[model samples]
Target: MWAMVTLDGLTVTYRDRPTLHGVSGSFAPGSLTAVVGPNGAGKSTLLKSILSLLPIAQGSLQVHTPRSRIAYLPQQSAIDRSFPITVHDCVLLGAWQAAGALGGLSNAVLDEADAALHTVGLCGFAQRPISALSAGQFQRVLFARLLLQDADLILLDEPFNAIDSKTTAELLALVADWHARQRTVIAVLHDHSQVHQHFPQTLLLARGVVAWGDTAEVLTPQHLGQARLLGESWDDHLHAA
Candidate 1:
């Protein structure tokens, strides 16, 4: 079978400078992979490229799943929590495409939204406005929405950034569940230890692929140091120019 997502010399530029340079890799079907690197290592950029949110300056990205079967949870910082929407409403939006096309949500879909909320440990939060939620609670809400999406290919950016240990463990369990069901899940994460414990496959990057393979092999001290040095080199080169 073909890979679920493939990148052949994928490159992305920002303000005429390449942020990601000739990055190439493929995510196998049902693979759970973590994208890791320094702050500006183009980790987030890769996720955006896969989602087609940003223009690719060169090469190609092929996501085998259909648009509707792909779900994305961007950084919590990017969401406008001030929007006047209830938690239930936010979760319900996960099924909006299908519900809209089908005229309305079926009762079963509505129940699924509630179940998603409950699964994420937000059982009584359905009627609360999202603006009132704490950062951890809000992240749970996002996970609940992802669950409702029931997507085949899920891309998560910084999924556990501000989450507490309990919340992080709960969310990670959900991620594990997704893997068990043969869904393709990719997340850009910062915590190497967390990635080591949870993700079996890793793509360590520094404006390009430093290492791509088993997490145990990719997150090595030497590889990590090299990634950091590459990031610093980019900074130094830009300062000189």
Candidate 2:
């Protein structure tokens, strides 16, 4: 498989404290991979670094694809649901790249947005404010936006977190569709069972990479235990020491 993303001794720090410590790996093109680890293991930090949203403190990270060809869905907490934007408008934002600064939305784009909303099971929610929707509904809206993005590389940070099982299944199916279309997808997930079932590759991290390979080999019990230990041993007060 071709490599879409590569990290060489990549490190990221926040306020002079390291969150990810020298992680090295590559994500295969058109592959579906799951990033799993205990909380505080820097899973989200890794994603942000890949998207170039966070400054890299050390080492190098490269994406073979262009920046505009990547799409990201951050953890729900990162989103402001209170923003007074309609569901339709929210999804339409995906077209900004294609529409450009002075370009207006053509009927084709509007129709596509409507169809995307329907695909996510939010047909009549077009005019509704985002705040009026539940966590699941908002997630669906985000997915609709992703659909409009039509990107080559998709990064999802805990996409299934706090959502209902039905919603999870729907979103998982959408992920499957992306895989079928040969899009590279890397998702940060906590559900071991779900990851095992859907993701063919797995990267187990603990501030550093514990394993990176086939899902079965990477998700071994020994690696999981080590990841837990690594997360537990993190010292937030180290700076004060």
Candidate 3:
């Protein structure tokens, strides 16, 4: 498989504090991989840095795919549901890349949006307000949006955090579908069981990479223990410019 994203000695800082330090790895094209570690392990920071959402203090970060071809699903907590938008509109937003800034959606795009909603089991919720839906339902809506994106690379951060088991299963199926389509998928996950079950590759981090490679090998007890210790010992006083 080809490398879709590569990071070499990548370092990211927040408020003069290093969130990711000398992190190096590559995400293979068409592969399903998970980023897992203890709290403050820089899991989310890695994703953001890949998307160029954070300032890279040093080192190199390269993405083979174009920015327009990338789709991102941030953690639910980062979204504000109070925005006055219906589910249909929210899903339609995914078509923005194709529709362009002032381009209007034709009947075909509308049809695709409807189909995406149905695929995610949100057919009747198209006209429903985003603020009115439960956490699980909103997640489904986001999935529908991603469906319309047809992106080459998908990045998900804590996708199944608070959802029910059924929802998690349903969402995992969509992830499988993406993998089957040969699209690259990288997700930040906390559940070791889920990572072991679905993701073939894993990258363990603690402000820096503890291990990276096959999920089973990288997630060993020793590696996990070292990651936890590194995360716990991270000094907030270390300043990086």
Model 3 lDDT per residue over 111-184, tens place = 99999999988878989999999999999999999999999999999999999999999999999999999999
Best by TM-score: 1
**Clashing residue pairs, candidate 1?**
none
- Stronger candidate by TM-score (1 vs 2): 1
Model 1 per-residue lDDT tens digits across residues 73-172:
9999899999999999999989986877567888999999999999999998999999999999999999999998899999999999987999999999
Model 2 regions lying over 4 Å from their true place? 235-241
Please write out the lDDT profile of model 2 over residues 7-115, one tens digit for every residue. Answer: 9999999888888999998998999999999887889999899899899989999999998899999999999899999999999999999999899999999999999
Question: Could you tell me the TM-score of candidate 1?
Answer: 0.97
Which candidate, 1 or 3, would have the higher lDDT against the true structure? 1
How displaced is residue 97 in candidate 1, in Å? 1.8
lDDT of 2 at 238: 51
lDDT of each: 0.94, 0.93, 0.93
Error of 2 at 64 (Å): 1.0
Q: Tell me how far the alpha carbon of residue 183 in candidate 1 is from the true structure, in angstroms, after superposition.
A: 0.7
